[model samples]
Target chain A: MVFNYPNGKKYIPAAKIEAAPKIKKQKNAAYSNRGMTLEEDLNDSNSFYLDRNIAVIHKKPTPVQIVNVDYPRRSAAVIKEAYFKQASTTDYNGVYKGKYIDFEAKETKFSTSFPLKNFHEHQIVHMKAVLEQGGICFVILRFSTEEEIYLLEASYLLSFWERMISGGRKSITKEEVIECGHKIPLGFHPRIDYIKVIDYLYKLS
Target chain B: MVFNYPNGKKYIPAAKIEAAPKIKKQKNAAYSNRGMTLEEDLNDSNSFYLDRNIAVIHKKPTPVQIVNVDYPRRSAAVIKEAYFKQASTTDYNGVYKGKYIDFEAKETKFSTSFPLKNFHEHQIVHMKAVLEQGGICFVILRFSTEEEIYLLEASYLLSFWERMISGGRKSITKEEVIECGHKIPLGFHPRIDYIKVIDYLYKLS
Candidate 1:
């Protein structure tokens, strides 16, 4: 279950399975014929960019809250108790083509719409802040069932976020996304060629 | 004892004391009447800038390698085993005045020179990556005994770093830093006025 705070930060307080099992599930899914999940593809693409000196982007490490730790004589410090912490910002951020790029990636099984609940109020607030700072900010939407992906500008998402708060539709229609967002064609070397789309939109040469 | 990896990342493998004690030491150091240490003062300054909407900079959370975690019914997932992981990049990064700002802050007790040991090889590489991308990258050097702070650009530090590897002096003399870096005057609210120096260097209005 998701426990959301007033500021729109949701905390998943309990785990149905252990950490290793959870990771194993992801690994199995990653090996599926679909190449890899959008997240893994993005990570691999970022690594590819880094190795080639094309760009420097990294997924921020998962935030964890430590409660207890044990210091063994000659081994690594063992964390005895900790909890996952809600992140205050988006997942990906770095420099590309002399500009700061910030984005979030989300995948939905639904065919017709991207659920608004996938994003949080705080994330929208963060995107706005990045925009105000003149940073390039956006969200990558992946329709897993259809194997399609689109990059939507933060400004467009912000309007929809505000509208949802004011009693509008709970999700953005697939048609709306297709109209406003750039379609990122998947490829081999850099599986998700989102940078090409960024250059097109921002005119960064 | 600090465990130094060949790549220059230091791992505090064993905690001499509990996590609370570790934080307490930092807190006590932060409460000095003369002025907070460079790290504390910078944290305060960042908070000031954040509250005033002047900038959005943040220290990355310490990286941890989680080995085991426990799930209690209706409660948070507790990490049972983990180790502190070495960070690949600098401590602080964020948006400032429509530019990407990335930096690491370090203080030296030595009065004569800033030792090269304070910085890691990987950090130098990370700084260089940021620089190549046209990001504003630098290191804030605090001569603690002298109660002076200087903003040294990554390029300047990179030169010294390369010199050290080529059998030069193991440190950068105070005179050299003074010659190449900008002095940041301490203030009340924000404490360290480093952004003023950035504005001067970058000619950002």
Candidate 2:
């Protein structure tokens, strides 16, 4: 999936531009072996939540800018020309126990640190806006190499983002993530049981 | 703009498929006269609210399923083939004062009643889920002919939808809407000024 800014510049994520590890090959192999990506697992878990009346969360649709569309008389309209517009917000959001929940999910090959560049400038702005409105916002980071998943609050991520902007660390170390974030145990029925961590973190029940 | 179901059926809006007045030309004229659509006005209002540190609301991007892409040498990747997918949920959603806000906006030429078919089945189901989760869910109906706008709670909408499904009135009478819904006064800085109505209806100070 190629995403472009409104100005038509191709967005090359920093994680993808790295040279050391063969992430692409591993990504393909992971798909074959695991049979799902973090996004797919999250989507599945969200549906499980919905079915059980636990929460109402969904992945926002990928943003696309349609340029030219063709209406073939007897068939559905077809988009002939379009560009992938960059998203201005996080990927998933919904109402959880009467509280607004917003978050983004990302997986990295690194075992020690999660790079900050995996997120865009607009997404941070969006997270700040959500936090200001008193909504619960966070990021779910998966260290593929270590097979560990952690949920880090957006406030901590925002501080790190500020540090990065001021010429500090470009990545959040695993130790820092461990200190500030909560680990979510993977499960079968709901796949990644993130709501449990949320419940515990917020003392919702 | 043409939208389609994931099953490939073209979605002709209930308002557009109706006969009598040429809604397309008037829709185009509306864009020319007001210098915006309802979506545009709400977007402007949301930005105004954002700049003033009031609330955070946004219209989700149009959903599209990409079928083919062209990554020509040095140029940005272009979507060569795609199809618009029917949205599985309402359009605008966000957080306001620690509460989840979810709603859809529709402008109709009808002056007497608002057609039930203006909404899709999936949207109604999604609205039910939000309501069950204790989220603020409502519909903003713009009666273009009367130059009036009303915010009808999702519960009223669900009842009317049930009536429609059980061979009752296919639309909600304007009188019923006036009795059950809150009238939102049009504004300058915030455009539609719907949040004020939200504040009043929800009794949030």
Candidate 3:
């Protein structure tokens, strides 16, 4: 079961099993076959960047509320009871080349369109705040079907989200994303060469 | 009972009163009278700075491992079983004046000295990593006695920590802290005007 908060994105319970067979099949079908999930891949890429002194972006630790703990002798403390807490901002943010970099990463199987509903209202609000502060804000979208990645600026995202609210476009078409975003070519040393895109944006800004 | 991991910081279980009374009292005494803890004050200050476009800094969310979650109708998802996860980096980090700023805040009640025990080995390693990447890393120490605050650079901390391992000094002397650290003058608008100290360091660097 997934929990939907008013301001934030939906929370998919990591441990919950769906009762509906159709939905379960869909969820299973959506899972990537890259050996690691998108989060893990990003984390690995961040580590790679950090190791090479390319950039210092990091995924924020998962928020949790603690209730009980056990202190066992000669071992690490064991957490007895805790709960997941809703995050107030994006998953990844850091500094690079004296610029504040903020971004959210999402993966989609759709070859032709990316859903706007994947983003939360609070996230949009946060991106707006970052933009206002002169920070570089963007999103990394991975189209698994085509094995293509794109970096779309927060400004474009804001416009799309606003349009969605006014009953305009429900999702951003692949063609529009291709035109608006910089295609991020995957590389070996650092699998996701996002800094190159940042460099490109830096020059434009 | 507090949990102590093999390679992680020790966590004291606040709910386990019967475990150790003296330690509990000490911890409580350290935080007792402060209207807002250092972290809370810094968070408020960060929000103020971000709103004004003066600076950008944020505290990373607390790490939590979710085990089980229950999705009940019409309410926030309840996390049934979860565990606290050790953080891999500092609590607060961001960009200011094109410099990467990273730090950990700690409070001690001792009037004469701040115990080395308050700092963990992992934190030292993490600070070293930040420093190697050309980022500014420091610790904010709150001496509860005289309500004084100090921003001690990671270089100074690493030197002191090394000395402690060699049995030189168990804790940093209050006099040494005052001499080495940049004294942060408190203010009304931002409360803790740490950026002033950052400015000093920036000039020196």
Candidate 4:
């Protein structure tokens, strides 16, 4: 099952779109940037870091399978038919002060809990492999209703995912997330200022 | 101008495609995999490294700007109209054992020299930033005719690019490339074992 979230153009299975208990069509739109504020903020923050020569992280481009293309005589070729391809890795990754950092930014409208279905099975696997390879991996979770964001390590998220796999709660309560994740304060210059959290957690600086 | 080489589709400016003194559309067809063997090879090699728990490198997906989409009921969303966007960064980048690894792979069929036009000005600027941030930056240059691949440090490529801006030679002679870069031997499992070259260059081992 492909969880297409790139460019905010989701091609998710109908059942997976609102896996949360009380999610509605309008609730998803209430969040900033069509529920992708975390991504945009991270992009702004990464650009800030790159400009300052602090980090070199970038979001991977939206993956698409090109089916047909029309080459105009003297203009750019247009992709006529294409489908979103399933991403095999986490969305954001790069090197920070000689350390490998990888993570995914996810925003949820749920007030009390972050739905586990927001993540895919393959992403869990990818996160595990990244950690095994000694890469720093995590997820930037934004709870829109709470106006809170957290940088939760992949290992913690993976364990919660495993619990759900063996028929546990389908979501993690916000309290539990707060217990494990580093709260990211919003800023003006870098916007999210996630690198500060990374420096603190990884002791890079 | 955007060089659309991700899917073996050419969206190059007409003049830039045949920048070499002696080139035609027929000549581009001579290279393997529709002149995208280098990208394919690197992907294969990256997978090998990931599976072996060695490195966490990945090629960024081809960037596309989606203009229109059709979300059918209970069916996958289809991208109806899209266009290739100019890539701001080099194609491949990831973390390798605590080092940021970034690179662009270009295959040139010209026997005498590797054309500098295979690169872009922004890419040169990006390579410089990556270097300043202490990242491992380079280009994987494959001379299709010589059956040789070289990992030339981005510093060298950047110098050559600057010279081109001041009306120097538009290409780096094959002899100069051999002298400055490390020749990567083709391997069976990883296809192109570029990490070995990086390991030696950075003294990682």
Q: lDDT: which candidate is best?
A: 2
Per-prediction DockQ, in order? 0.27, 0.32, 0.23, 0.30
Complex DockQ, candidate 2:
0.32
Docking class of 3: acceptable
Model 2 lDDT tens row, B1-205: 2221222122334454242223333564544466566777788898898888899898888777666667675336676766667788899999999999999998778889999889998899999999999999999998876678899999999999999999999999999999999998888998889889888888886
Better of 1 and 3 by DockQ: 1
Stronger candidate by TM-score (1 vs 4): 1
By lDDT, highest first, what's the ranking? 2, 4, 1, 3
Superior candidate under TM-score, 3 versus 4: 4
- For all candidates, the clash counts are 2, 0, 6, 1
Per-residue lDDT of A1-205 in model 4, one digit per residue for the tens?
A: 1123333322334553333112223444656444445666788798899888898888888787666566665345666766667787789987777677899988788889999988888789888887876778999998987778899999999989989989999998999999999898877888888889888988889
Model 4 TM-score, 2 decimals: 0.84
CA lDDT of B87 in candidate 4? Answer: 76
lDDT for predicted candidate 1 compared with the true structure: 0.76
The TM-score values for the models, in the order shown, are 0.85, 0.86, 0.77, 0.84
Alpha-carbon shift of residue A200 in model 3 (angstroms) = 3.8
What DockQ would candidate 1 receive versus the native complex? 0.27
Look at candidate 2 and tell me the lDDT of residue B54. 91
Name the runs in model 1 displaced over 4 angstroms: A1-35, B1-37
Give candidate 4 regions above 4 Å deviation. Answer: A1-28, A33-36, B1-28, B33-36
Cα lDDT tens digits, model 4, B129-198, are 8888778899999988777889999999988887888999999989989999999997888889999999
